[model samples]
Target: MRPAPSDLEPVSRTAPADGTARAGRSLPRVAAALVLVLLLLVIARLPWAGDLGMHAATVQRLRHSLLDPGNPLVDADTPSPYYSPWTLVLGVLARLTGLSVFVVLRIGALVGLGLLVTGVLRYVRTLSSHRAAPALALLCLLLLWGPLLFAWSGFLGLNSLALTVSYPSVFALGLGFHFWAWLTRAVRGTAAWGTWVALGVLWALILLCHQFTGVVASLGAAAAVLAARPARAVLPRLGAALASGLLVLWLWPYYDFFALFSAGADLEAIHRPLYEHLAARFGLVLLGVVALACRARRDRRDPLVLFFVLGVLVFAAGGLTGHYSWGRALPAALIPAQLAAALETVSAGRRAVRAGWACVLGAALAVGAWTQAGTLGYVVPRDRLPAAVAAKYRTPWAGYQWITRAGVRYGDVVMARTFPARQIPAYGPYTVAPGYPDVFLPDADRRAAAVTRYFGGSAAQRRGIVREYGVRWVVGPESLAGPGLRKVTAGPGGQVLYRVVP
Candidate 1:
């Protein structure tokens, strides 16, 4: 049974009579709006970094061949997990509008950002009636991390969001917040069979878009259902929803969603970093941990507490078993704790307790903001930034557009080293080997070996690799001179572009 209104702490929903008090209440909203605007400008700049090329390559493939867009990074006909429903839609937009992949990503960033902001507002309303809960929750979500600035696709810290706003992960995460809100309402109130089915389909789409974020979303959904404590009648509806979701996953023709489970061995190494520096990277969220404990004490089935527990269990299992990829679920644990801290600040009954919580949260936010202050360099000129803020800024990678300018065309195979290979495919050229890991591609190992041999092997070995992959162009440093190779142009970082001789 739900608690009586009188038993719950009073939430401030109306502006105070005093003008100063009204203005003070509005400050958080204003601050949050300003931060969002800064993020929008950052999206416009679209700083090039990790996985940008991979996503760009996906869209580029879909644009040219919607039906059979093949492998995104390599010239193969294998299906790819990256070709999700979201990217297919993006591919259609890029084709119809004749826009660059980056331009399409910018549009996607706008939509994803809007979804995220409104989703937070909608979900927070279910937790607290306080007028400031949504704004405070947004702030806490973005700034409740420790001083070390960590940037990853599924993570939602300010710096991380800035870097990954254009990624499918952001769109998946935005949809996840909405998923939680919808599940909460559906479980709490009577809903038709159709509603449950729709919710199930939405859940599948989230998973298809970004698998890591999808895991986080699934955990949040489970927490919502468990906390609602539905009656026996709801079990059938839940089963129907599960069936619908599994059907969609099975029917997704682009890639085998279930097959991804077997591919975990290839991913553990890359995700190992997620397990490192936990205290330094996420220590500030301990405030939220305290708040979650408070909530759990009052109600054992509290959704946030359950969410945190589930996330910790999975993350701990990953570390113990060397399956570090499960660390992507860290946000699942962090998010509820952050929301709890924000909600407690506004709903605490005692004035002294509220004030103390606000002070600690405020100090934590200040430190976090400074830790992510380097984000300002995305909008402001780096040279114009203060020394302290500028010191934190890491320069984004300059792209491989230079090779394209020298006549590298779509579907043209370019022999490049690992770093250049990572970025070149973004401009529509195929690399000899994929820059990132590819679980589905059967010849991934062979392709990688071919690239290594072409760069460091004997002349006969280089010729054999070029012939085997049909390489038309090669990109490397100035020292990369050889017979049957003609210098085409130079790019950033003293790199030389070479074309194969007939």
Candidate 2:
């Protein structure tokens, strides 16, 4: 049976009266954090960068075809058979708002941002109940910057900013924070059944969002529970784990998610230097380490602190082993925990010293977030098409617009070398044969190469490529026209569409 609202208050181990007081006290910090998160999200206007467009397209497909027999996810004919609960939520939002999936993608980013801030605040509170630490640590998170080890690198702060587009990863990281914090309470015997239920729900959500993230969170949860007094902690942890497992089994293809563990094991090593991974929160890592050393004699065996420190090392190792996402999630899971610990260690300092540290931390986070936000100021627009045509495509903007309006159809395979795969779904419910790059899609590389060949290959090669991939229409420069292909429409600029000869 579900618990009553009154029952929920005790879950936090705070009496009703005390809980209200704490909530009142925390409200200002939460409000300020909310403003900061919203500001970063709004300023970034995080567009469809990277593979976000492909995910948007999936949501588009789901929105239109949920009841249709040709639903891409259920149909075995489609190239991608993967599942994404996040896209399902986006689909529902798109329907409710009557907005395009592209817009919903940005909204998802905003939601992820809010959750991330909430999780960070919860995490910081675990190490220190000092009222100011959440605000201070969060400010540093939003504004700090560290040295860039290379030209094409991102810091931890930048990674958070990029959360504007990485809905799954960001959402998972946010939930992982809450999961760890809840697990901390469960292990300490301060939590009620509701807390275990909350942890399980959060874990289930993370699993549905992304399997790799679920694995990382599961490790952290298991560590926290195991390190606690096992006799007392085992039942709650087991209950939470069972609830999570049952939820996963009920809502998702749990086995498929498990298979993802070894999916990219064979890929070439793309190892990042330790500095690039840690630079974003290098200051926190340094301060936390220094504080840990300074208090080694007294606090050396702190379970929560040790878990997070080991997390940094584990994720660093995972990155070295070619799991880049694991590496990126490290700072999200560990930094706040370490920062909270650092603050607790230094809480005995004079007021002036504490204020000075806070100021320095805030400035560094601001610089980092601002620097990262600058990179996204002019990212791809959220419109159905880019505002202007590129000279390289030699196509007028109207030409593509006409193609989108006249020739595109549901599930039609459109081929274009210069046009982005994202544009097809944005403008019409069509698929790009070799569309945007998605790590999950097996045929992404093969189809991407075929798109190149369709535009540049000889007549026979183009036909073979077209037949092989079931190319419905080719949209590109007129010069690339070949036999067995009749011009459907020679629109303005260099835009020309050819129907594949049956």
Candidate 3:
């Protein structure tokens, strides 16, 4: 029987045979570049929203105390998962350059975006030598998701990437793509022991950088390895690599990497949202599903199909077992499907089929782009946008910089509502309770109760709560005034700042 048409066809056949075709191929590349530049500009703005404050606070702590940054959210000396290898490097940059934490994050965003773009190109090249494959794959990876706009750290939809470009998730994901590419090449050829060990170290680094993306990376790597069906001789090298990676995870000093496994219960509530609106969130990738089915028909060991299957199993188990944190692994399935769709469109043996796939993909991409058009509000004035686009834009949260400007110093404990609590730490002050969950902070529940009492309890109880936590400031509405509280200033959204008077 004849072998199936090689997905890894030579560049000559993949590239356009004529000037017009070459121009057509070049168009997508140019569009991809423009999209990247727009993302960079969005990074420059660094709109404040979910987890940005937490990350900014993490950098601030690391900048001040690299080895002992403590808990990023509350005023406590505890290890935090946010103190990963990538954040540590950013912390050092903040300390060395005397740049603000947000500026450091912008720099980090540029680096992450560079890694992601180049990594995608390299990994896609391993699948298809087509000159346009990388460009098309980039476009698909960024835009090929369901019509509903979902923004999360690990998800790579255009709107999501715009919001989370500066996050460690992006950095980890970039490394993940490179990991898949390297693993693919290593399994196919002879590799030195040192090379395998280095790969192990890289894997550990990716895990430490962003644990969720690390899960996705692990699944992809496993797919690549299993699809290769390595010889007996390669098993020893694979073992060495695994051992090295485990060693790194064990030796990590900032936090107990294994401790995170037990913290899943605390995280499941927040992650449940990941499973909602599945069809609206990922419907566009069905095209890729078709592509994977085609590939699987020809070769049962197809890596993308294996990766998707592994991701689905983990995700389904999460939904069934109330381990919603595992939902973060959805990207592991989505990415391969998205890439497969892009590759099959360009590499189909017949012109008619390729054109049909391309037309479908092109239409899907256009719809996806419109769904995420609200991201343009980050670069352009929302009012200037068309009504449809403007309506899609969700305003970012205002920062708590006013309280900081009013003299709330580092380590100052502020009693605030949940919303303000989320943003205050970015400016160096800690809230009475953490804005997000804290697995390591032993007094999280008590702290939360204290915050609640301060807000709604009797005056005497409020005093007791303040004395217990050493609260120096109170942030709330003007109606919150009392004898011990003196108004300092007002903030956005009618938030009043009050200093505790002895």
Each candidate's root-mean-square deviation in Å?
5.6, 10.6, 5.5
Query: lDDT per model, in order?
Result: 0.92, 0.56, 0.91
Q: What is residue 360's positional error in candidate 3, in angstroms?
A: 0.3
Q: What lDDT does candidate 3 reach at residue 396?
A: 83
For model 1, what is the error of residue 272's alpha carbon versus the real structure, in angstroms, after optimal superposition? 0.5
Q: Model 3, residue 246: displacement in angstroms?
A: 0.6
Q: Write candidate 3's Cα lDDT for 285-349 as tens digits.
A: 99999999998998889899999999999999999998999999999889999999999988887
Task: For model 3, give the 10-residue run with minimal summed lDDT.
Answer: 3-12
Across 1-502, the per-residue lDDT of candidate 2 in tens digits comes to 9998888867666676576546644753674565465556543554334445446566776577543313231112333322466767777777777886657767777776677778877876776787766765565454443543122112235443553334576667677778787777777766666666666776777776765566667766765665565565458556876676666646563124544555554332343444354555354445455544544445654555555656767676766676655554455344535454436433736746654654554454454444443333333332433333221111112224466566667667667763445455545445434343334455656766777776767888887876675668777778866677778887766668777776
- lDDT per residue, candidate 1, 398-442, as tens digits? 998888888999999999988988899999999999999999999
Estimated TM-score per prediction? 0.96, 0.72, 0.96
Q: Please identify model 1 stretches exceeding 4 Å from their true place.
A: 1-21
Which pairs of residues collide in model 1? none
